[model samples]
Target: MRLWLLLLLLFACPAYASEPAVDTLPPELVRLRDEGRLTVRALWAWKLVPAATATAAMELRAMGLDLIGADRAQLAAWVREAEEGTAAFSPAQREVLSGLLAMMDSGDAAASADMLPADAPAAAALPVPGVVDAVPAAPDTVDTAPPAPDVADAAPPLPDVAEAAPSVPGAASGPAMYRCGAARTGVSDASGPAGPPVELWKLKVGDGPCTPPVVLDGLACFGSVDGHLYAVDVATGALKWKFFAEDWVDQPPAMAGGTVFFGNVVGDRSGDRHFFALDAATGSEKWRFKSLYYGVNSSPAMVDGAICFGAGKHVYSADPQTGDAKWSLETSDTVGTPAVSDGTAFFAHANRLTAVELGADAEKWTFRAGANITTCPAVSDGLVVFGSDDFNIHAVDVQTGVEKWKFGTGLIHHPAAVHDGVVYAVSADNLHALDAATGTEKWKVNMQRAGLKAPVIDGDALILAAGNFLVSLDRASGQERWRFEAGGEITSPALAGGVAYFWSEDGHLYAVR
Candidate 1:
């Protein structure tokens, strides 16, 4: 035969002798290879899926997914044997081989590969990697002092911190969690001094403060990175009590019916599913409601004897006394603190604001935003105001889902503070006071940095954390009234009973008057 014809004749019908006609790999490996959501590149980037089979084997062993390992040559030989039908994998022993094949083929690696189960294994808590200590340098004008002893351990009776100011009419006597609830309106009947504020006392907590001073009765309750929820005396900064959790307590504590409700992040899952309830008078644990989802970062709202909070993808309503889930609303995305007004629960999440009926537990209306909205919505007078990452402050009519107006602003990570007819938005670069009815800018002040919390409306002054300072601005014209550098980036400040509280990144909580 001719050379070309001889070669063709030899190659034809010679390769199918031992090959399995259909995919005979284990079901799990097959499933993973075909159904994984992440791209191979993404898996490699997360270090969950390695680019090389040998590396993948090592990683799988380290993560405890695989025990019997193989070297690169052995791995190659196994693949070749399986391909040539010299060996076959059984279900019981397929995980390692299947994992390698699935990763090689860019298959679905299972969600567990991305996130560990909450109850899987408890890990040690170091300083919480990737989280920076928030202590900023103290301002040149202010007295830079060392942090006091841990407030939970050594807080002393502080002197009077309240300064004389006009009282806000009809201020509700409640803890200022999220500074007046998840709408983050930060509005309070408590008023601060007309002039510059003086630091009454500074109490050192652990690092990574979220929001603070949910003052109820005479105690100021707050959470810290030390994995403890602390209650300090409002007048004297004295340590009242502290409750420990599994991880960081970043959300402010909500209070109602003599109980305090708060959530904490367990491990890297944001927060575990448990929403904790404690006795407000004592630091004793009352009850904890386990939800269907984890990572409950939003502050809880007490509405009609029930506590409502956002966790993962659902907004949950539970009994405040028994810690039983009453109802939950499946939302489009992960939700924030819910604002309850006139039987309607307003939630800001993803790129829309959803209003669900508290009584019926049904979605009433949804106002779509141009971008994702992480901040909660402030609802009042049939109007809901919130800020979006889209760099706009939106005012939507609650009854109809119709957008009233959207005022252009910089990047806004926090909610808008709606008071009377004016809306205060702390954007990425400026503090803007807008007309709520028309979304028109009344005045804008250069705040120099975006506020992480809503501007706390303390009578005439707006207390906000801008840049590294806890700043008080004129609520009407957005004029700077006073500012105190907290020597760390501040989260949100809370105002109650004429005493303003600041939670800074430097692991210090300051009470200012």
Candidate 2:
């Protein structure tokens, strides 16, 4: 009885051991494929091998994903099954699987399905997401269907070829040049004598003050450290749209054609900079240029089918159509926007004003100043007027490259604006009007304790923003005409349409008529 019992036990133990240890799959994986919790069709294209295939690796690389250990033969066999119209996958899924397989064979691992020929059937398929192996179904549970034809067996269509280039419109004749950073192309049409100020309308923008606004096709555009460039309706002061940047925008925007351009500082060293062009009507991004130097502080200028701006120590001229750089002029230090006149470009670098011939790629001349130039040069009436930190206003003959004259103001800031024949500028405590022809001081007004910014001229009034005051003065004399006070610092220059537009440092943009 004991021997029989031992034999029975030994046999039972052997039977138990041979029974394939009750194979069990993980709940997560089972849920992934079986219940549509995840789909097996998506995993068909993943290459199983790391080496043995360059195309597979590149595909993974372009998607910013990593592939570790994988089996090449297993991956290929799986792809072949998918391409042959395996019923386990939908037609759309099989197409994606085939593309992934072809990418692997081509050694273009990063190649995207979008790069496939438009006529390729796989191009119409939706791709699977994520990375992992599909759980194989039981043999009895596998779907039965007719196998698909291999794509490699079919000849691809010939590539479409083109020879004649498309015609483009010829460039329009260049607009007349005005030197003084003044937007005025010629004398104004208004001929009325000075009288009582006319009120148009007043609309408040925000609390933080902003730079003078640029007007384009009835849209007034300006930027603030508040990180927005606003376009307001020129007639109604109604909000059009606001474009946001990564950081503060201290400079006014430049508007040309139908685009608006501006820049901002970014990154740890503030060395990361970006320039953006937005649609003038919709405020959508048209294009952008980024750099590793601190953001551009100078406003951009457009001329001769190019957009030019200063970035770090280089001056860039980019194609207006595609934002492609045409050429760059490298410099040793920071520079300002180049003023274009008659195919010549003038810009201030450190303490020197340099002239560059636009198409010739040569320096025409450079005039030395005692201090750095922080303001844009105004060109008009055959003379160039600008301010320098050296505490003097220098007037140079544009044609002869000679210093017409220099007047010391004792306080250095930016240069003056020239209109008619007078140069208007401001020092720390005084505003001076000088004769542009000879640089002779015409009249001086003591501000006592006021802090003034660059001035703008509208008709017969000089618009100036100082501290909390936006003051208008008679152009012929230095007498204050009208003043409006708001409770904030005035850091930007004033702009005038029919009404005066200015911003307060307290974050408010104001329009006074």
Candidate 3:
């Protein structure tokens, strides 16, 4: 068969003098070939037609080749072609294409140029004024230069460290700590030069317990069961402004961008609960959203321009400025307050703890705990720590959503507080300290009654709120340093500010010195 085919070819071929020179192709064709626009035949090539088509559109756009002019119909067609071509591109190329499409849609072509690869020849060919030039390029080669001298190495002139003014006594090392919850559970460790000492300026706003006062810009804002949210002067406890809601507001207000956001519980009615954003300075309503659930006990969390909170069995992300719904994530159980870090949101539900990616309503993982979770999950150092109704403290890996370790306490309602590589949790009858890395119990101190709230760590002390008394213990030894009895039963942890603030179940807010 081979011999026959060779004979046939020899007879069929015309007597050509010589082969044509490959370089004789037109300059335009040569340029296209150089830019990888030409295709070659291969035995098993998988042609990504969609990606190729998208690339063709993008390259044309990048080169400022306006094939569709300014006609709306032509532009639509061009965008459709580009969209179809996007499926063929690599993931990185697809991301660039998506960003460019977004910029074009927003009428910011100049901004789209910055998303172009620095090495892209098209970027150099087509310069975008102002916007694109600011993009920094990744270095392709490392520079080997002699190390610069350290600032400390040059002892040119010394500012006498010993002559410097002695540090102020009783001054905080950083910013004044801010706490959340009626018990003031969320306090920052930052302390600096002592501002005025934080005094408990009590105001009789209502008959019921007020939500934890949120301090922002010298104003302390809180909501009461009386259906009113009030902003009081932190210095004098004077009323600045107040806003009324349709129902009870139990959650702490979250302040962001000069606005305060909070949720309300439905009162004897059957419609959506209200979530509102108010002007920080005036206490006027900026925007309000109706949650499609019975009540929203969870406090709103603000990040970027979105407000996040849970109602019923769903967690929602709403625009803080416009009160528009960006996305909603449905959960198996009611969600608690959500804490965000590193583009991920951590939330607790009645039976599970869920971690979801921000900006995209996708679940990273759901950890099922055998009991209900009432407290918010705290995350730090790549670990998530929370307490369950099953009387256990669980620590899980943040990245893989896998359980690292769990310590059972055999009592419900213990809240977990994490600080300095230690998890402090309280059972109804004891305070337990566990290693944050391994969940091993460092020490356990028995109390006479249940501790419904977590211990607050301040400096070297661990403060515990046990039913009717406040106990401060040494952090390292768990030895009781001091104990104070209040007039009524105390269920929430106390806030530390030189002095401490706590609420009694009988509905009185107290400041203990």
Tens-digit lDDT track of model 2 for 329-355: 766566565676776767777777777
lDDT for each candidate structure? 0.61, 0.55, 0.55
What TM value does model 1 have?
0.66
Error of 3 at 225 (Å): 3.0
Give residue 101's error in model 1 in angstroms.
26
Q: Using lDDT as the measure, what is the rank order of every candidate, best first?
A: 1, 2, 3
Candidate number of the best lDDT: 1
TM-scores of all predicted structures: 0.66, 0.60, 0.59
- 21-55, model 1: which lDDT tens digit per residue? 45432243334345532222222222333222222
Worst 10 residues of 1 by lDDT: 134-143
Please state the error at residue 499 of candidate 2 in Å: 1.4
Q: Candidate 1, 351: how far from true, in Å?
A: 1.5
Candidate 3 per-residue lDDT, tens place, 121-177, comes to 332233222432122211211111112223422212211222222222222222221
Please estimate how well model 1 matches the true structure, expressed as its whole-model Cα lDDT.
0.61
Alpha carbon lDDT at 129, candidate 1 = 23
